[model samples]
Target: MRLSRAFIRAVSSPATVAWRSAQSRIFCSSPSDYRKSQPSMLKHLTSKIKATGPVSVAEYMREVLTNPVTGYYVRNNMLGPDGDFITSPEISQVFGELLGVWIISEWMAAGRPKQLQLVELGPGNGSLAADVLRVFGQLQSVLGGASVSLHLMEVSPALSDFQAQTLTGGGSQKADCEEDPVYRHGTTAAGLPVSWYRCLEDVPAGFSIFVAHEFFDSLPVHKFQRTEKGWREVLVDVDPEDSGKLRFVVSPGPTLASATLVQANERRDHIEVCAEGGVIIQQLARRILNDGGAVLIMDYGHDGTKTDTFRGFKDHQLHDVLLSPGSADLTADVDFSFLRRMAGGGVACLGPVTQGLFLKNMGIDTRMQVLLRNCHDPSTRKQLINSYDMLTNPTKMGERFLFFSLLHPSRLAAPTKPHGLKLEKRSPVLLPVAGFTDLSFS
Candidate 1:
């Protein structure tokens, strides 16, 4: 379908949004030094390291990302062209549309559950959720009038406001939002009740279809660098030469916490592990195992191996990890192997498939053809084409990003295989899930 000017406005160009722009700066004061020009989180980290010694990469990421006042995510629009990076949903409507379709297909495959909790994690500006809602809203009859409760897990106040505005078509200035610290509930344009939570655990109990796009990578990971004697924990410490600056330093070797990596690592090799991610996957897997549902995670990461993928971004460009602290977005590769192991034998885990292959298998090419034919404007057509290339291009987000799905075995009639998860594995469950043709789940 051809998008109107308003739809175009809704899917705004990242370059035009001021909040996404790198030029936007947030200022703050620190407890240690009132006159320090650095961001408050930066000063806070420095003081923390000075007083408590260096911290693990996971601790550093947690503080920098969600640090109430000066954290990057809490205060900024970190998506789109103007932001540190542009996610697939922001790049084109096709991405979200296909995802929405996939959700519907899964729901249908599950015998059309009367009540489904459609949940999203870290919904940036709520664009993907909004698009998903839109698609589902249009297919009410086909869905047999299934009731969907939209739940968004977003800790950032600024991003939550944007999400509410996008989904509900109104700002969240109500008395309840201000009064409720733990949770705030609203309704979308379609009258579907929307609830916001600070974390995943707060979401109400039910069979859910969870979607986490680029969310896992943001979870903090502890980095371990192998040394001569043994693996040591990588810590962020204040630079001795320059007191105000921060640098990474290795802690004492033979770290017990990193003992798991002894066999996986070699001398001088670095490995990253996101214990938080594993905990979350375990929780989600348990929920899915207990209650019939599925979890889809799309992010950039490896198949559970050793690598120093932790990095930072500022103003749509790569930035030094230890330079400005919470002023920039810090992220690392999501180790899918860790997630798989976390799932254990409770749920069925699917592909760490490339985003490009998943999307193409899901029929992005056909969707693009439809849009291109409907779109007459040369400029819009060009924009759509470029977006298609960017999303599917191997040199771009295509190969870098992965599509991982976790399904409850009960969702299918028997233990049947789902698309993308069709590689050699212990489980013989395989089905032709749309968008995963010929792709090996291994």
Candidate 2:
């Protein structure tokens, strides 16, 4: 729907209004101000919807999460305690250190490539990268510094600056000229200088170890619900009460459009389709297949065959994603099946293991024991115990979070299928729809 010039001006900043107006006059007659001014676009959408029909939840979500000016990721700082939620690296240095060890093991498994590209996608504040690098720095004899190149793929200029500071061991305000890890502004797969692209093709063809922690879940997801009539897609559109807000709206669109949304039992009420995540995984898989490498993905999600998992967070508190356009974090559960499929036929998929089990298997308990033995203060010991509990508790982040890995056939032996891959049946003693509401986009 077309938005009026006056309406755009009403919701846009003076500078934005002036720039957009100039662009409109010079490039096109239609006011494209809505591209930058989310409030205006939402307002326009809401007004049009009253006259039209209800918008689909997918359309609504696409607009609010990706709208250039007001979409969530485009306009907001979405990581860390101050933002929506704190990721593992942000929670403790130990997490990244252990990951570094995991990556090094994977590299060794790859026959220790003389020239290895260590790549990370959506590296927030670069904390994980820095921690990994620090750990690797100590194992220089095994890692041959000259042979390894660190590459980070990020988009936010603010985050890029933060990542640089974190990686260089400098104050947040200062830029380190000497400590540079090749930084790319966009997708490494795209052909933008082995640095910037919309996808992975941008990365130079080579053996690389990839890390994506708390990454995939953030990608936009298409929500679907099983109904007697068939499956319908959910959409996001402007909310009527708040001109600046966006809300989930269901649409009559067929679910077949989303490859991840396969036909399911008629009783299942919701499902999520992660087309973007699938595409990314497939691209990475193909790269690994062509060139020997491995990838590790860690995040909170279920490995079940059928379930709808969609939710939002803001300021460490659960918030209605529809409250504000581009202001809160919108996310959904990751489907490891899609990831495995994307790896084509040859790559090996591992885990879907509980974070608790993964960490314990990796010797977190031993690490904790060593730390406790070294510590003197009782308070410090208490703190460590508390943190350990929080990290290991099944009801908390421990059991709920999961870890999965993909490896090339030549690099590592195929992982034995994890025993915990099956979905647990909910006790009938609990409400029949107990878990059902938890998956709602609303």
Clashes of 2: 18
User: Per-residue lDDT of 1-442 in model 2, one digit per residue for the tens?
Assistant: 1223243222221121111111111110112223345555456556655554444344455566666666666556677767878877776666676677667666765666777778888787778887777667665655664366667666555566666555543322322432333333322111111232223556677988888887888776666655556665554444444445444544433433322244454345777756667667877777789887888888877665657567678888876655544566777778776676656677777767777766665556766777787889999888778777777788887987877777786543432212212212222222110111111110
- Compared with the true structure, model 2 gives a TM-score of 0.74
lDDT of 1 by residue, 132-199 (tens): 88778765655667889898888898898888889887634443555464466778877888888887
Q: Candidate 2, which ten residues in sequence have the lowest lDDT sum?
A: 433-442
Q: What does candidate 2 score in Cα RMSD to the true structure?
A: 12.5
RMSD of 1: 11.4
